[model samples]
Structures are given as structure tokens and as C-alpha cells.
Target chain A: MKIIARVLIILSAALLVVGATMAFASSASSGSGGIGPGRDGFERRPPAGAAEGSRPPGFLPGGAFGRGEGRGDHEGGRGMPAAFELLKNLVIIAVIIAISTLISRLTDGLRPQRR
Target chain B: MKPEHRTYIRARSNLLIDVATFIAFLIATAPRLSGIGIHEWLGIAFAAAIIVHLLLHWQWIVALSKTMLRKARASSRLGYLLNLALFIDVTLLTFTGLMISEVALPLFGLRLPRGFLWRGLHSTTSNIAVLLIGLHLALHWQWVLKTTARIFGLVRPTAKPRQEVSQ
Candidate 1:
């Protein structure tokens, strides 16, 4: 019962944040006359290959949802193979871990040594 | 449960939760590889996972909060601040994600207005979260290793590090 209460509190807090964001977004869009508060004027559109009605609602094949207009060319399927994309992300993470470890070590070294 | 046994169980749970959250983050980051559908759904699930993660460490969070501005060590204070920033960033990420949701929300019979600002913020926060996660993991890397070793029966139950509570 205690666990359940904690979960409920977290969920409620999250929902409150979500509600605030939605209200902000609604005002921003309204103020901009549907240009969507995008300084670059990028419009929100369905991805070109989404085939909205053709597939199951929330799950799509690799070729379908991640391609075309909604995002930049680099984020779509046209740029790289799936495996390569995953590899690239993993490599970024590896570099981040290395950098983080180095910073940690450097900080630890700065502290006075114990007798 | 014996105190040592209880500690072991907690350690195991933390390790599992951390690993799962990290994998989910990796997959969510590579939207093109996992497809936008999986990305959206996994991102929502990831939010839930994060809540659980925080709950697991709630006692520590409470303890640190009381002392963070008073007598907590510099590292603990730093970790707490970083965690606070991460929490705020994640809240923004989830909110922007929902605002620009393409798949998950639509499936639930709800559709938010198309906001290019929200989309931009979503992408930005997603990238920022990668760095925060890296730092978060780095801070807890020792705890992770020790817990894993204990779990595998390669190490005996021993004194935990002083800063482990911040983890």
C-alpha cells in the first residue's frame, strides 16, 4: 500500500507538469496563428511514408514512420542503415562514458590524500 | 530478511532497474533504427520506469535533501543538483514528447495540436538527456560494479561507499 501511494504521487506530479506544458503550448500556438511557435517556421506534418490508415495504430515497420518530411534528412531512413544508426548512437554513449570517467578521476585526484 | 540479505536484494533491484532504463534510453535515442512507433511507446514507458527508479531511492533522496545545503559533502551536493536538473529536463522532454506525439497519443484517441516549438524542444531535450544520463551513470558506476559483483557471488557483502546514498 505504501508503494502504491508513492507511485500515485509520482504519476500525479508528472501529470501536473504535462498539463502545464499543454497549456503553454496551446497559448503559444494560438499566438502564432498555427505556425506553431517555430522560429524556423518548421510546420508539423505527418511523416511522408507514415501511411496513417494502412498500418496498425501505434506500431509501424521500419520503412514507414521514421522517413520523410516530419524530421530532417539525417533522422530519416534515407541516410543510414538501421544497424549503423544504432552503432553510431552506441559509439556516442561510449565516448560520453569515457569523458565522464576522466572528469570523475580528475576530480578525485584534486582531493587531499588520506594519511 | 537479514540486514545483509535486504541490502543484497536492494542492490540487485537497483542494478536491474538501471540496466533496463539505460537500454530503453538507447533504443529511444535511435528512433530511426527502432522506428518512431517504438520510440514513442518506449519513451512513455521510460517515464514510468524513471518514476520507479526514483521511488527505489526515495529514502536516500529524502535523507540527502535534509542535509544537502547543510553538511553534505561536495560530491553529494553536486550529485543532488545534477539529479534535480535531470528531473526537470526529463519533465520537459515528456511534456514536449506528448505535445508533438505522432503515434502513441493518437492511438489513445487523443491528439494534441501540432506545435513545432514542442517538437524542437523535444529533440533538444532528448539530446541533453543523453549527456545527463552519462553523468548519472558515471556517478554511480562504482556502486553498479560492486552490486553486480556481489550479486554474482564474486564479492562478499561489505561496507558501501559513503556517497552511495546519492545514487
Candidate 2:
């Protein structure tokens, strides 16, 4: 029962965040002649270039969101190769861990010794 | 189970799940290699894993919350703040992913409006997540190494829980 309550609390918090985001987006869009219920009670037409089946350029070969969009060896949307990006992320993680270890050691060194 | 056995089991479980979560994060970060379908599905799975991670550490969360403003160690306070930021960033990342979902939501016959805003937010949040997750793992690096050594039998498991176990 306690576990259930905790799960419920988590779900409620997540829902609140989602709800707030949607509400803020709706209001923002409504103010800017956005996509909301039209005078005819239909969704106002999707914004220009926000058309259906359009995908943004991405590093992934099959594009970012949709399936079967692009499926061959092609350069990433970014000028660099995809492998380089992967290496970059890995290197960043390694560097962060190394620095953290150094800081942990430094803090321990600064602390008073326990006899 | 004996208390020592229980402690060992818990340590092992924590190590396995944390490793899995780290791998999932890595794969999800690289949609280019995993493809869009795997990336989206893995992201949804990652969200579930994160909740489980928190559930496993619920006691620490409660205890820390009770004393965060008072007697908690400076490192613990810093960790708590980092975790809070991670939770918020990941929440936004998952929510925005769902909002801009093209493959997963459509499978359920629920097609949300595709907006540039959702897409942009998803990208931004994911970028922030990389840094946050890096810090999170770094903070726990000692625990991870020690746990792995114990689990692999290079070092015997201790009966007493370490101070850092609260994290």
C-alpha cells in the first residue's frame, strides 16, 4: 500500500508537469494565431512548414522522428561524422568522472583526520 | 535471507540496475546509431527504469528531504540538488519526447500535433540531460567501483552498509 501511494504520488507529479506544459503551450499558441479550435470548430491548419510527414535534419540516417525516411550511408545533418559525436559524448563522461574523483580526493584530504 | 545475504543481494541489484540505466542512457543519447524506433522505445523504457531506481532509493530520499535544510553533509546536499535537477530535466525530456512522438504514440492511434516547439524542447532537454547524467554518475563513481569489486568476488561484501549507501 505504501508503495502504491508512492507510485501514485510520482504519477501525479509527472501529470502535473505535463499538464502545466500543455496549458502553457496552448495559451502561448492561442495568442499567436496558433493551432487551436478554429471558428469552424476544427483545429486551425498546422503552421507553415509544420506540415504532416516533415522531419528535421538529424544525425541519424533514418531522420530523428519518423520511420523509413532516410536509410543509407549519408553524412550527418551536422557536418561532422556520427562516430565523432559518439566519441565526444563518451569523452565528456570520462572527463566528468575523472574530475569528480579528483574533487572527492581533495575534499577528503582537507578534512580533519579521525584517530 | 540472512542480513549479510540481503545486503549483498541489494548491492548486486543496485549495481545491475544502475548499469542498465547507464547503458540505456547512452544508447538513447545516440539516436543516430540506434535508429529512431529503438531510441524512442528505449527512452520510454528508460523512464520506467528511472522510476524503479528512485523507488529502490525511496528511504534515502525521505531521509534526505527531512534534513536537507539542516544537518545533511555538504556533499549530500549537492547530490540532492543534482538529482533534483536531473529529475526535472528527465521529466521534461520524456514529456517532450511524447509530445513530439511520431512512431510510439501513433502506434496507439493517438497522434499529437507535431510542432517545432516540442521538437526544439526535446532537443534542448536531451542535451542538458547528458551533462546532468554525467555528474550523477561521477558523484556515485566510488560506490559503483566498490560494488562491482564486491560483486565480482575480488573483495568480500561487508555486513555493514557504508555511509554512502544512503545515496
Interface RMSD, one decimal, each candidate: 3.8, 6.0
Across residues B1-167, which tens digit of lDDT does each residue of candidate 2 receive?
A: 77777777887898899899888888777766776688789999999998899888888888999999999998899999999888888888898888767688889998775455666667778878888989999988988898899888899767676743476
Q: Give the poorly placed runs of model 1, Cα more than 4 Å off.
A: A19-34, A38-78, B159-166
lDDT tens per residue, model 1, A1-97: 9999888877786777767766776666555652235433234454566555643232343323433222422342454566565566567767877
lDDT of 1 at A61: 38
Assign candidate 2 its CAPRI class.
acceptable
* Candidate closest to the true structure, highest DockQ: 1
Residue-level lDDT for B86 in candidate 2: 89
Task: Give the DockQ (C-alpha) for candidate 2.
Answer: 0.28
Kindly report, for each predicted structure in the order presented, the TM-score of its chain A compared with the true chain A.
0.61, 0.52
Error of 2 at B163 (Å): 5.9
